[model samples]
Target: MAALTKDSMFERHIEDVEKDIVSVTSGETRPAAGIDSEVANFFASQSQGPIEIDEATDRRLRWMIHKRVLLVMVVTYFAQTLDKGTINFASIMGIVEDTHLVGQQYSWLTTCVYLAILAWEFPTNRLIQRLPIGKYLSFNIAAWGAVLACTAACKNFTGLIIVRTLLGIFECVCQPAFVFLSTMWYRREEQALVIGAFYSMNGFQQCVGGLIAYGVAQIEGQVLKNWQILFTMLGCITFVWGIFVGFWLPDSPIRATCFSPEDRLLMAERVRKNETGIQNKEFKWYQVREALSDPVVWSVTLISFTNGMPTGGLGAFSNLIIKAFGFTTLQTYLLAIAQGAIIMTFLFSAAYLSKRYNQKLLLAIIYTLPNIIGTVVFLTVPTRSDTKVGLLISFYLTMAFGAVSVLNLAVMSNNVAGRTKQVVASSLVFIAWAVGNAVGPQVFRANDAPRYIKAFIAHMVVYALQVVVLFFLRLYLMRLNVLKRRAAALRESTANGEDRDEHLAHNHAFDDLTDRENPDFRYTY
Candidate 1:
């Protein structure tokens, strides 16, 4: 080449090096946008070797954090379940006998709590974002514990109603706050297992609460009834736990002191990598709008609403259903313990499947299928002595969906990207849950006892509907994933092309500059 220019020589050298690099790198390929090379160069200049740390030491640190966080969440949720379930326990202890409430009025007690939860959910969730989560959550836990204790002092339907309303308001903060706290600590892949551990307590509480009630029911000298003693004991335990939370719970990875500086940095980077970005410094209105406009949000909400109706009915009246089997109070309490154990087993299995397969919607539908079958058996099976065991077992079997509820929460959190949108979506989902709870209890009128035919039929219908909703929701999610992949491919192709004018038009049409501005942004699946 006559008098080779420096540019021509450099170009020839680059081409030769590229061929050598491609040969040695095997199948490795670069991103069309040049982002992969850019990131590789940045990391290459930062260090001469890979980072090192003691694996065993890191393991111990993670274990400590996991234990502390799990304990706090389990105790908090246990207190909530105890407060809500005390009414069911109390019903068996003759509170209904003393209060003289009739017909649908008893159902109103359950309804009122849910209504209050619905009214306060969104505002309380937003408050969690604005405040220090650990402190705010602890205060709420303490307040609700005090309210639970006060339930022991109620003398009539009105007193019970007032106490339940207040309890609902305070307890509204627990679930959302706990979810937010857990998210701050873990990546999405690890989230389901931790969430499952905490959520398993919903089943465990039935066992623990039943045992406590059995012991309290034996108390003969108290001025108040034994059921009142049950409430007071649970409340005191919860209050103490709240005090412990204030000292033990850390705000976030950035602020936590339980780990070394390196561990903290690792935790932060791990989360950032999974989320495709660091924690947002400020909320964005556009992100909120995008989340609200998502079709999956509504689909997820409807599935929860339908699934919750049967869940609420069962949770609120499982004791009454057990009592219908003609067992003594002590026997009923023992059976409740067994039921709780079975539910726990089922919950754990479902949680494992959810984590291992990343198949939440499918797992939810599978869980609902059993309940639908149980409801049908309970409704249609003859009430003869021979069929009694089937009915009782079916009643206990329906509670297996406890894991599905946990999965639903995890799904919603993972699927909503922005902080504020996650909060809003959570609030909306729980509001649907509250509304379902409000409607569920009304199906089990006092007159429908022994068979509760109407309640059984209602549950069947609702559960079947839930299965349908989950099927369609899964399809919707699959289609959305396909569309997102296609869009990403098209963007990559445009970025790699040579047509400046066409690329500019395409970029303007697709708002491609937004992606460049925030390169780390990712759509939640």
Candidate 2:
């Protein structure tokens, strides 16, 4: 049957059950009217299961969404990555010496950014949920762009930290908004690769930013320093792009003015197979309680933390490590291009393997093992002129840490199913991310600078923790899937074999129910 026509039989059936109490995982039902009205309107509004769309239609529709939705996500992520990595680029461009930074002050610059993110993540998530997420991100993009531009004016540690903190507050919205947008615009099967497409921009920016830094560093006889020019140029570009996104990117299927009314309904219908609701405005606190208590959620959260520490240390120190191995300033910038390539390769590979083989947790461990081995080799290799080549190779291998983030989001986005719960759980994971980042730089103390052997040692241990946590997480999800299967079988026998799937259908699909409350929901590893 066609979806969304009011005159149809499905629309009529929807009217009858619009307010009907529905069964939950606990076998209890309550008056629930908390889903997005766009989704709640007309037929197939709440009651129908997946609409069997043809493969051709699916391909065309996905292409349209990629153009309209995923493109915006990609550029926004790319712009943010450039602005965030500018400080690392600037480390060689004279920001530290010009600003009179000494000892641990440089490390604190990196730490303070994540600390600000850790402090503001929850409130930022709340605003993201309550607002038009696309527009909200646009505003933040412009705000952070302006803040990054102001980094050119900082004359001391205090000034740089203040601006960095503001930049963190604004940019913290990027990841959460994109995670929720993956749910809004794509099917469950498509989310992993779609997320990777945007996320790989970090590596893309690494290449692009390195070349830009190299060109800017060659400027001579200029009043504005090379670092100053770098920040101001990227910052202005980001600010302008934010303005463009505000005008261009559509909010959601319900509010997408770019598509025809018929297309909007079709878009909404397309995502219903997720068995997860499209949009929800109401804040349900009990769902927050559930996310906090769930061990599976915590397992993902821990993996994020473990993965974050190594990334922080490496991101902040890797360029310096490269410079320390007898390379010139220009060579360091040039070498970072290879680092970006390594990052892009790992991210693309992880995304592809997970989507093709349906093995996220296993792939996460695979991605991490190289990072562990790389850190070991990095510490063991002599930091001499002769071993610089070996040292660079080891450092590049450590870039695989960037790939783990794809798996974290793939597992988190596919598993969690409620607005507030998603908000809280993702926030917790990033909070762990922030704490680990904050701590990651501290291990690379100035006393240990040059090789920073302690930092490499710390990362080896952190990578091991990540592998252990991810193994248990995989086991936990497997156990849940088994229990769900057994429960379905038991319920089937009790129903006298009356096509038990008929009873287990997604009756609460649009109720804004948490995954735990939706009996039809299954875990995705």
Candidate 3:
């Protein structure tokens, strides 16, 4: 069946009927007009049982869905991160000389990838909404893998830039799509762990890349550079994996192929309390405006931007920094594995703590502390033989700041409710992320060389600001939740006295109301 459009009578009836449905669902007396004819009818016709199914069924179905989702997410994310991490490995393996990169050209190679991502973020998100997400993502993954493989043939800055730019364009859908998919399949509480589980692949790849790159670098083929070999090998693996995605991955719970008919219904029913309606393809302009005007949306965008700087910086240059510490190329790769360990430790721990404590905002703020301290110590600690260990430790600590970014992403996905608003909000956050990454590499000027004191100082300022934005964002959400609870209370009292308005009794579940407009909606902080 086609989805209801804005002009549908069902859509028109949503506003009036929403309160009735909320009241009925909350166990209040039925409205006098009889919700049986409209809102209740919609539910009864669509499913076999109540929207809230039995607890055992809900739990069993959640585990099944989570198992499938995490498997796909972890593998795909690991592949994506591994491909991206190749540049850092390549830098150590003589990409500069082979590509004939001149002053700041290597930096541009890194920057342009993100530049492409920033440029394509909005359009790609819109496409994700319009198309089948699983297929769209699979196609892009394959395309990027091919592009990454082509990078092996590029012998100059222009060639490298072209391939890298295409890689960026192809990969741009990844973060937003994963976040959106997580929201689609998981409840708000489960989303943080799902996102953490998948995104922690960044750390896993770092750990794996060290071992892989170390091995791949030993291949001394007369026809290709080790960097080229690295690109070709990972790219081919991803291309094959993309095919797997197309065959197996589901776009959303409703479209899931692995579940039984009853299980799929349970999946849909499970997330109604999320208050964020499931997938809606038709774009609503008002939701876009609402997302733009929301202060918390902007706060999350700022956090994405600021936190992305260190990511861009470290992703492109962490190995070089280790190399500068007088380690051989092989040794630098091994030492960088420690950075990955640190990153995984922080990300997994923060995600677990956020899940355990139910405090994403608190964890986000707390996680930034390490990066702030790391940057300060990296700058203040003298560059001596003995202090080199401290410098490396500080570098590892910078990765702890990255966990704040993971938590920030969870916060965005958790708080945004309407489908259109979530899409727009996701794109905006990642666009800021892309911009920060683009800017990050440019700051690590060739003149800065080994110490890069200026870059460290810049990171210090951004991370400090990140903590402030997180606090404000939390307070804003708390205030909104309070207001919503009060409003719902008022509606409940008024609902008890009034005769049911027929127009109001026809509320549709999929009307796609923004959280602010949906009185039943509450922000999860």
Tens digits of lDDT, candidate 1, 423-522: 6677888889888888888888788886789988887777778778777667655544333333334332332221223221111111111121222222
CA-lDDT, candidates in order: 0.69, 0.82, 0.80
Off by over 4 Å in 3: 1-49, 490-509
Q: Write out the backbone clash pairs for model 3.
A: 16-504, 17-504
lDDT of 3: 0.80
Q: Give the TM-score of candidate 3.
A: 0.88
**Per model, how many backbone clashes are there?**
0, 0, 2
Specify the poorest-scoring 10-residue window by lDDT in model 3: 30-39
Q: In model 2, how large is the Cα lDDT of residue 112?
A: 93
Q: Per-residue lDDT tens digits of candidate 3, residues 309-368?
A: 888988898898877866788788888787788888998998889889888888888888
Candidate 1 residue-wise lDDT at 9: 74
- Residue 44, candidate 3: alpha-carbon lDDT: 61
lDDT of residue 101 for candidate 1: 76
